[model samples]
Target: MEDSSEPFAILPADMFGQVTFIGGVSVEPLAAVGIIDEALTLVNDRLTEFAASPSFETDMQTVFGESVDVDLGRTIIDALSLGEGLPEITVVPAEKMNGIDGGFDSLTGGVYLADTSIAPNSVIGREPTQSPNLADVL
Candidate 1:
Protein backbone atom coordinates (compact mmCIF):
# COMPACT_ATOMS: atom_id res chain seq x y z
CA MET A 1 0.00 0.00 0.00
CA GLU A 2 1.09 3.60 -0.49
CA ASP A 3 2.42 5.25 2.63
CA SER A 4 -0.43 7.02 4.28
CA SER A 5 1.89 9.58 5.80
CA GLU A 6 3.39 10.26 2.45
CA PRO A 7 2.25 13.56 1.10
CA PHE A 8 0.07 13.39 -1.99
CA ALA A 9 -2.15 15.95 -3.58
CA ILE A 10 -3.27 17.10 -7.00
CA LEU A 11 -2.13 20.59 -7.90
CA PRO A 12 -4.50 22.37 -10.17
CA ALA A 13 -3.23 24.69 -12.87
CA ASP A 14 -3.01 28.29 -11.84
CA MET A 15 -5.02 31.03 -13.48
CA PHE A 16 -2.52 30.75 -16.32
CA GLY A 17 -3.29 27.04 -16.87
CA GLN A 18 -0.06 25.57 -15.50
CA VAL A 19 0.11 22.71 -12.97
CA THR A 20 3.11 21.24 -11.16
CA PHE A 21 4.36 18.43 -9.01
CA ILE A 22 4.60 18.63 -5.25
CA GLY A 23 6.11 16.54 -2.40
CA GLY A 24 8.54 14.78 -4.73
CA VAL A 25 6.10 13.03 -7.03
CA SER A 26 5.33 13.33 -10.73
CA VAL A 27 2.41 15.37 -11.97
CA GLU A 28 -0.98 13.85 -11.07
CA PRO A 29 -2.01 11.45 -13.82
CA LEU A 30 -5.59 12.58 -14.25
CA ALA A 31 -4.71 16.26 -14.35
CA ALA A 32 -1.79 15.63 -16.65
CA VAL A 33 -3.81 13.50 -19.04
CA GLY A 34 -6.50 16.14 -19.27
CA ILE A 35 -4.03 18.91 -19.90
CA ILE A 36 -2.26 16.99 -22.65
CA ASP A 37 -5.50 15.96 -24.26
CA GLU A 38 -6.57 19.58 -24.32
CA ALA A 39 -3.29 20.69 -25.81
CA LEU A 40 -3.45 17.98 -28.46
CA THR A 41 -7.03 18.81 -29.21
CA LEU A 42 -6.10 22.44 -29.56
CA VAL A 43 -3.35 21.50 -31.96
CA ASN A 44 -5.70 19.37 -34.03
CA ASP A 45 -8.31 22.08 -33.99
CA ARG A 46 -5.86 24.76 -34.94
CA LEU A 47 -2.94 23.29 -36.88
CA THR A 48 -4.72 20.41 -38.63
CA GLU A 49 -1.50 18.62 -39.49
CA PHE A 50 -0.49 16.92 -36.27
CA ALA A 51 -1.15 13.40 -35.11
CA ALA A 52 -0.02 11.28 -32.22
CA SER A 53 2.32 8.57 -33.38
CA PRO A 54 1.80 5.02 -32.12
CA SER A 55 4.71 5.39 -29.76
CA PHE A 56 3.87 8.92 -28.73
CA GLU A 57 3.23 8.99 -25.04
CA THR A 58 3.09 12.02 -22.77
CA ASP A 59 6.02 12.19 -20.44
CA MET A 60 7.93 14.79 -18.49
CA GLN A 61 11.15 16.12 -19.90
CA THR A 62 13.25 18.75 -18.23
CA VAL A 63 12.72 22.30 -19.34
CA PHE A 64 15.07 25.09 -18.27
CA GLY A 65 17.40 22.30 -17.14
CA GLU A 66 20.79 23.57 -18.17
CA SER A 67 21.86 26.43 -20.44
CA VAL A 68 18.35 27.19 -21.76
CA ASP A 69 19.84 25.77 -25.01
CA VAL A 70 19.36 23.36 -27.88
CA ASP A 71 17.40 20.47 -26.41
CA LEU A 72 14.87 23.02 -25.28
CA GLY A 73 14.61 24.44 -28.77
CA ARG A 74 14.06 21.04 -30.32
CA THR A 75 11.37 20.23 -27.77
CA ILE A 76 9.44 23.34 -28.71
CA ILE A 77 9.74 22.62 -32.43
CA ASP A 78 8.50 19.10 -31.88
CA ALA A 79 5.56 20.22 -29.77
CA LEU A 80 4.62 22.76 -32.40
CA SER A 81 5.04 20.20 -35.13
CA LEU A 82 2.50 18.17 -33.23
CA GLY A 83 0.23 21.18 -33.86
CA GLU A 84 -0.18 22.52 -30.33
CA GLY A 85 0.45 26.05 -29.20
CA LEU A 86 1.86 25.97 -25.73
CA PRO A 87 -0.59 27.57 -23.37
CA GLU A 88 2.13 29.53 -21.62
CA ILE A 89 4.97 30.17 -23.99
CA THR A 90 7.03 32.45 -21.79
CA VAL A 91 8.50 32.34 -18.28
CA VAL A 92 11.02 34.38 -16.31
CA PRO A 93 14.52 32.98 -16.01
CA ALA A 94 14.11 30.69 -12.96
CA GLU A 95 17.70 30.97 -11.79
CA LYS A 96 17.94 34.70 -12.26
CA MET A 97 14.84 35.54 -10.30
CA ASN A 98 15.76 33.19 -7.49
CA GLY A 99 18.98 31.88 -6.07
CA ILE A 100 19.73 28.22 -5.37
CA ASP A 101 18.98 26.70 -1.97
CA GLY A 102 21.68 24.03 -2.24
CA GLY A 103 19.78 20.82 -3.05
CA PHE A 104 19.13 21.34 -6.77
CA ASP A 105 22.13 23.31 -7.82
CA SER A 106 21.79 22.60 -11.53
CA LEU A 107 19.86 25.84 -11.81
CA THR A 108 22.37 28.21 -10.23
CA GLY A 109 22.75 31.30 -12.34
CA GLY A 110 19.86 33.06 -14.00
CA VAL A 111 19.15 32.48 -17.69
CA TYR A 112 16.39 33.16 -20.17
CA LEU A 113 14.11 30.21 -21.05
CA ALA A 114 11.73 30.84 -23.93
CA ASP A 115 8.53 28.90 -24.71
CA THR A 116 10.39 26.59 -27.02
CA SER A 117 12.42 25.53 -24.02
CA ILE A 118 9.80 25.82 -21.32
CA ALA A 119 6.59 24.28 -22.60
CA PRO A 120 5.25 21.07 -24.18
CA ASN A 121 8.53 20.32 -25.87
CA SER A 122 10.30 19.81 -22.59
CA VAL A 123 7.23 18.19 -21.01
CA ILE A 124 3.50 17.97 -21.14
CA GLY A 125 1.06 19.34 -18.54
CA ARG A 126 2.16 21.98 -16.02
CA GLU A 127 5.55 22.47 -14.42
CA PRO A 128 6.06 22.25 -10.68
CA THR A 129 6.32 25.72 -9.27
CA GLN A 130 7.21 27.10 -5.86
CA SER A 131 4.66 29.81 -6.20
CA PRO A 132 1.86 30.62 -8.60
CA ASN A 133 2.92 34.26 -8.44
CA LEU A 134 6.20 33.34 -10.11
CA ALA A 135 4.58 31.96 -13.22
CA ASP A 136 3.40 34.17 -16.05
CA VAL A 137 -0.22 33.17 -16.35
CA LEU A 138 -1.33 32.57 -19.95
Candidate 2:
Protein backbone atom coordinates (compact mmCIF):
# COMPACT_ATOMS: atom_id res chain seq x y z
CA MET A 1 0.00 0.00 0.00
CA GLU A 2 3.10 2.36 -0.13
CA ASP A 3 4.76 4.12 -3.07
CA SER A 4 7.83 1.94 -3.66
CA SER A 5 9.86 4.50 -5.64
CA GLU A 6 9.46 7.38 -3.18
CA PRO A 7 12.43 8.46 -1.01
CA PHE A 8 12.17 8.55 2.78
CA ALA A 9 12.76 11.71 4.79
CA ILE A 10 12.91 12.33 8.55
CA LEU A 11 12.43 15.60 10.43
CA PRO A 12 15.52 17.27 11.92
CA ALA A 13 14.33 17.15 15.54
CA ASP A 14 13.44 13.47 15.32
CA MET A 15 16.73 12.64 13.76
CA PHE A 16 18.61 14.62 16.35
CA GLY A 17 16.84 12.93 19.27
CA GLN A 18 17.24 9.43 17.82
CA VAL A 19 20.88 9.81 16.84
CA THR A 20 22.04 11.63 19.94
CA PHE A 21 20.00 10.31 22.87
CA ILE A 22 18.80 6.91 21.72
CA GLY A 23 22.06 5.98 20.03
CA GLY A 24 24.28 7.24 22.88
CA VAL A 25 26.74 8.96 20.58
CA SER A 26 29.59 11.04 21.95
CA VAL A 27 29.25 14.04 19.62
CA GLU A 28 26.47 16.61 20.02
CA PRO A 29 26.03 19.14 17.22
CA LEU A 30 27.24 22.26 19.04
CA ALA A 31 30.15 20.44 20.67
CA ALA A 32 31.18 19.00 17.33
CA VAL A 33 31.02 22.44 15.75
CA GLY A 34 33.23 23.83 18.50
CA ILE A 35 35.73 21.00 18.10
CA ILE A 36 35.84 21.59 14.36
CA ASP A 37 36.49 25.32 14.87
CA GLU A 38 39.30 24.48 17.28
CA ALA A 39 40.78 21.98 14.81
CA LEU A 40 40.66 24.59 12.06
CA THR A 41 42.51 27.01 14.31
CA LEU A 42 45.05 24.30 15.07
CA VAL A 43 45.56 23.59 11.36
CA ASN A 44 46.01 27.30 10.68
CA ASP A 45 48.54 27.55 13.48
CA ARG A 46 50.44 24.60 12.05
CA LEU A 47 50.50 26.11 8.58
CA THR A 48 51.71 29.46 9.86
CA GLU A 49 54.37 27.70 11.86
CA PHE A 50 55.59 25.80 8.83
CA ALA A 51 55.56 28.87 6.57
CA ALA A 52 57.49 30.90 9.14
CA SER A 53 60.03 28.10 9.61
CA PRO A 54 63.26 28.38 7.67
CA SER A 55 63.29 27.11 4.09
CA PHE A 56 66.77 25.79 4.66
CA GLU A 57 67.79 25.85 8.30
CA THR A 58 71.35 25.02 7.35
CA ASP A 59 73.52 26.39 4.51
CA MET A 60 75.29 23.88 2.29
CA GLN A 61 77.43 24.34 -0.82
CA THR A 62 76.76 22.80 -4.24
CA VAL A 63 79.37 22.56 -6.95
CA PHE A 64 78.53 24.03 -10.39
CA GLY A 65 80.16 25.61 -13.41
CA GLU A 66 79.42 28.49 -15.74
CA SER A 67 77.05 26.29 -17.74
CA VAL A 68 75.53 23.94 -15.18
CA ASP A 69 72.70 21.74 -16.43
CA VAL A 70 70.05 20.71 -13.91
CA ASP A 71 67.62 17.84 -14.19
CA LEU A 72 63.90 18.56 -13.91
CA GLY A 73 61.60 15.61 -13.24
CA ARG A 74 59.29 14.03 -10.66
CA THR A 75 61.08 11.80 -8.24
CA ILE A 76 59.49 8.55 -7.06
CA ILE A 77 58.85 7.73 -3.40
CA ASP A 78 57.83 4.73 -1.24
CA ALA A 79 56.45 4.05 2.25
CA LEU A 80 54.86 7.34 3.31
CA SER A 81 54.37 7.46 7.08
CA LEU A 82 53.80 10.04 9.81
CA GLY A 83 56.29 11.45 12.38
CA GLU A 84 59.14 11.58 9.88
CA GLY A 85 61.00 14.90 9.73
CA LEU A 86 60.37 16.77 6.48
CA PRO A 87 63.16 16.85 3.89
CA GLU A 88 63.97 20.19 2.27
CA ILE A 89 67.28 21.65 1.20
CA THR A 90 68.39 24.63 -0.85
CA VAL A 91 71.39 23.79 -3.00
CA VAL A 92 73.39 26.98 -3.41
CA PRO A 93 75.92 26.69 -6.19
CA ALA A 94 79.39 27.94 -5.30
CA GLU A 95 79.47 30.17 -8.40
CA LYS A 96 79.08 33.92 -8.90
CA MET A 97 76.93 35.71 -11.48
CA ASN A 98 79.03 38.04 -13.59
CA GLY A 99 78.68 37.59 -17.37
CA ILE A 100 75.29 35.88 -17.84
CA ASP A 101 72.48 37.85 -19.55
CA GLY A 102 68.71 37.31 -19.41
CA GLY A 103 68.93 34.27 -17.12
CA PHE A 104 68.36 33.68 -13.41
CA ASP A 105 71.63 33.74 -11.51
CA SER A 106 72.74 30.17 -10.80
CA LEU A 107 74.59 31.22 -7.63
CA THR A 108 72.57 34.00 -5.94
CA GLY A 109 69.23 32.83 -7.31
CA GLY A 110 70.05 29.33 -5.97
CA VAL A 111 67.63 26.47 -6.57
CA TYR A 112 65.66 24.65 -3.90
CA LEU A 113 66.73 21.06 -3.50
CA ALA A 114 64.26 18.94 -1.53
CA ASP A 115 63.60 15.26 -1.13
CA THR A 116 59.99 14.05 -1.59
CA SER A 117 59.45 13.73 2.16
CA ILE A 118 58.06 17.21 2.65
CA ALA A 119 54.29 17.61 3.10
CA PRO A 120 52.32 20.56 1.79
CA ASN A 121 50.56 22.82 4.30
CA SER A 122 46.76 22.64 4.55
CA VAL A 123 44.55 25.40 3.18
CA ILE A 124 42.52 27.33 5.76
CA GLY A 125 38.70 27.55 6.22
CA ARG A 126 37.56 25.80 3.06
CA GLU A 127 35.95 22.39 3.35
CA PRO A 128 33.23 21.97 6.01
CA THR A 129 34.23 18.68 7.57
CA GLN A 130 32.15 19.29 10.73
CA SER A 131 28.80 18.58 9.10
CA PRO A 132 29.33 14.87 8.95
CA ASN A 133 31.46 14.55 12.09
CA LEU A 134 28.89 16.32 14.25
CA ALA A 135 25.90 14.61 15.88
CA ASP A 136 22.35 15.46 14.84
CA VAL A 137 21.55 16.96 18.25
CA LEU A 138 22.19 20.58 19.21
Candidate 3:
Protein backbone atom coordinates (compact mmCIF):
# COMPACT_ATOMS: atom_id res chain seq x y z
CA MET A 1 0.00 0.00 0.00
CA GLU A 2 1.16 3.49 -0.68
CA ASP A 3 1.97 5.44 2.48
CA SER A 4 -1.00 7.61 3.42
CA SER A 5 1.37 10.04 5.11
CA GLU A 6 3.19 10.70 1.88
CA PRO A 7 1.89 13.58 -0.21
CA PHE A 8 0.40 12.49 -3.54
CA ALA A 9 -0.29 15.82 -5.28
CA ILE A 10 2.52 18.33 -5.54
CA LEU A 11 0.08 21.20 -5.18
CA PRO A 12 -3.42 21.20 -3.74
CA ALA A 13 -5.53 22.02 -6.79
CA ASP A 14 -8.02 23.79 -4.55
CA MET A 15 -5.40 26.39 -3.67
CA PHE A 16 -5.79 27.95 -7.11
CA GLY A 17 -8.94 29.79 -6.05
CA GLN A 18 -8.21 30.24 -2.38
CA VAL A 19 -7.55 33.66 -0.85
CA THR A 20 -3.88 34.22 -0.21
CA PHE A 21 -2.76 37.21 1.83
CA ILE A 22 0.71 38.59 2.42
CA GLY A 23 1.29 41.58 4.66
CA GLY A 24 -2.39 42.44 4.24
CA VAL A 25 -2.08 42.48 0.44
CA SER A 26 -4.19 40.07 -1.56
CA VAL A 27 -4.33 38.79 -5.14
CA GLU A 28 -7.49 38.95 -7.19
CA PRO A 29 -9.11 35.56 -6.64
CA LEU A 30 -9.66 34.94 -10.34
CA ALA A 31 -6.21 36.11 -11.34
CA ALA A 32 -4.57 33.79 -8.84
CA VAL A 33 -6.50 30.86 -10.26
CA GLY A 34 -5.62 31.80 -13.83
CA ILE A 35 -1.93 32.15 -13.00
CA ILE A 36 -1.85 28.72 -11.39
CA ASP A 37 -3.54 27.15 -14.41
CA GLU A 38 -1.13 28.84 -16.80
CA ALA A 39 1.86 27.71 -14.76
CA LEU A 40 0.58 24.12 -14.81
CA THR A 41 0.02 24.18 -18.54
CA LEU A 42 3.46 25.62 -19.21
CA VAL A 43 5.18 23.04 -17.04
CA ASN A 44 3.22 20.24 -18.61
CA ASP A 45 4.21 21.43 -22.09
CA ARG A 46 7.86 21.59 -21.10
CA LEU A 47 7.71 18.09 -19.67
CA THR A 48 6.08 16.74 -22.83
CA GLU A 49 8.74 18.39 -24.99
CA PHE A 50 11.50 16.90 -22.87
CA ALA A 51 9.88 13.46 -22.99
CA ALA A 52 9.91 13.57 -26.77
CA SER A 53 13.66 13.18 -26.67
CA PRO A 54 14.78 9.56 -27.08
CA SER A 55 16.78 9.24 -23.86
CA PHE A 56 14.82 11.58 -21.59
CA GLU A 57 12.63 8.88 -20.06
CA THR A 58 15.52 6.50 -19.43
CA ASP A 59 17.65 9.31 -18.00
CA MET A 60 14.91 10.42 -15.60
CA GLN A 61 14.28 6.86 -14.46
CA THR A 62 17.94 6.31 -13.77
CA VAL A 63 18.37 9.58 -11.86
CA PHE A 64 15.10 9.51 -9.92
CA GLY A 65 14.98 5.79 -9.10
CA GLU A 66 11.65 5.36 -10.89
CA SER A 67 9.87 6.04 -14.14
CA VAL A 68 8.48 9.54 -14.27
CA ASP A 69 4.82 10.08 -14.98
CA VAL A 70 4.64 13.09 -17.27
CA ASP A 71 1.47 14.46 -15.77
CA LEU A 72 2.60 14.02 -12.20
CA GLY A 73 6.03 15.42 -12.96
CA ARG A 74 4.45 18.47 -14.58
CA THR A 75 2.27 19.04 -11.55
CA ILE A 76 5.28 18.76 -9.24
CA ILE A 77 7.32 21.18 -11.31
CA ASP A 78 4.43 23.64 -11.54
CA ALA A 79 3.89 23.49 -7.81
CA LEU A 80 7.55 24.18 -7.10
CA SER A 81 7.62 27.02 -9.61
CA LEU A 82 4.44 28.54 -8.22
CA GLY A 83 5.82 28.37 -4.70
CA GLU A 84 8.93 30.23 -5.84
CA GLY A 85 6.86 32.90 -7.56
CA LEU A 86 4.45 33.48 -4.65
CA PRO A 87 6.88 35.51 -2.58
CA GLU A 88 7.52 37.90 -5.43
CA ILE A 89 3.82 38.33 -6.12
CA THR A 90 2.96 38.89 -2.49
CA VAL A 91 5.86 41.18 -1.74
CA VAL A 92 5.37 43.52 -4.68
CA PRO A 93 2.64 45.62 -3.09
CA ALA A 94 4.05 45.29 0.38
CA GLU A 95 7.46 46.56 -0.66
CA LYS A 96 6.33 50.16 -0.21
CA MET A 97 5.36 49.51 3.38
CA ASN A 98 7.89 50.56 5.97
CA GLY A 99 9.96 47.81 7.61
CA ILE A 100 8.39 45.05 5.52
CA ASP A 101 10.47 42.80 3.32
CA GLY A 102 9.93 39.25 2.14
CA GLY A 103 11.20 36.70 -0.36
CA PHE A 104 11.01 32.95 -0.88
CA ASP A 105 13.80 30.75 0.32
CA SER A 106 13.83 27.55 -1.70
CA LEU A 107 16.40 25.78 0.46
CA THR A 108 14.52 26.50 3.71
CA GLY A 109 11.07 26.24 2.09
CA GLY A 110 9.96 29.36 3.94
CA VAL A 111 10.01 33.17 3.96
CA TYR A 112 12.62 34.98 5.97
CA LEU A 113 12.58 38.44 7.56
CA ALA A 114 15.46 40.87 7.70
CA ASP A 115 14.48 43.27 10.51
CA THR A 116 12.46 41.04 12.79
CA SER A 117 13.24 38.40 15.37
CA ILE A 118 10.98 35.66 16.67
CA ALA A 119 10.77 35.24 20.39
CA PRO A 120 13.32 32.62 21.37
CA ASN A 121 12.19 29.32 22.95
CA SER A 122 8.53 30.22 22.99
CA VAL A 123 5.99 27.44 23.53
CA ILE A 124 2.31 28.20 22.95
CA GLY A 125 0.79 25.14 24.60
CA ARG A 126 1.69 22.10 26.62
CA GLU A 127 1.61 18.94 24.54
CA PRO A 128 3.42 15.65 24.57
CA THR A 129 6.01 15.27 21.87
CA GLN A 130 4.98 11.68 21.24
CA SER A 131 1.62 9.94 21.17
CA PRO A 132 0.80 7.89 24.24
CA ASN A 133 0.72 4.14 23.73
CA LEU A 134 -2.87 2.86 23.86
CA ALA A 135 -1.85 -0.03 26.11
CA ASP A 136 -0.23 2.32 28.61
CA VAL A 137 -3.30 4.60 28.71
CA LEU A 138 -5.63 1.66 29.13
Best-matching candidate per lDDT: 3
Model 2 — TM-score against the truth?
A: 0.24
- lDDT string for model 1 (13-115, tens) is 3222333322332333344435444544444343323223321222112334444454445566566555444342212223432442112223542222221
Against the true structure, candidate 3 has what lDDT? 0.38
lDDT of 3 by residue, 1-138 (tens): 232323222223332322233332333434433444454445445655665667775767786767567556545655554443332222223333354443445774434222121112111221467332211111
Clashes of each: 1, 0, 0
- How well does each candidate superpose onto the true structure, as a TM-score? 0.21, 0.24, 0.32
- List where candidate 1 sits over 4 angstroms from the true fold: 1-26, 49-138
Residues 1-138 of candidate 2: C-alpha lDDT, one tens digit per residue: 232223122112211111111121222434333343343344435544533446312211123333333221001111111212212112111122132211223455322211111112212233465321111110
Task: Work out how many backbone clashes candidate 2 has.
Answer: 0
Q: What is the lDDT of candidate 1?
A: 0.34
The window of 10 residues in a row where model 1 has the poorest summed lDDT is 109-118
Stretches of candidate 3 off by over 4 Å are: 1-19, 24-26, 55-104, 110-138
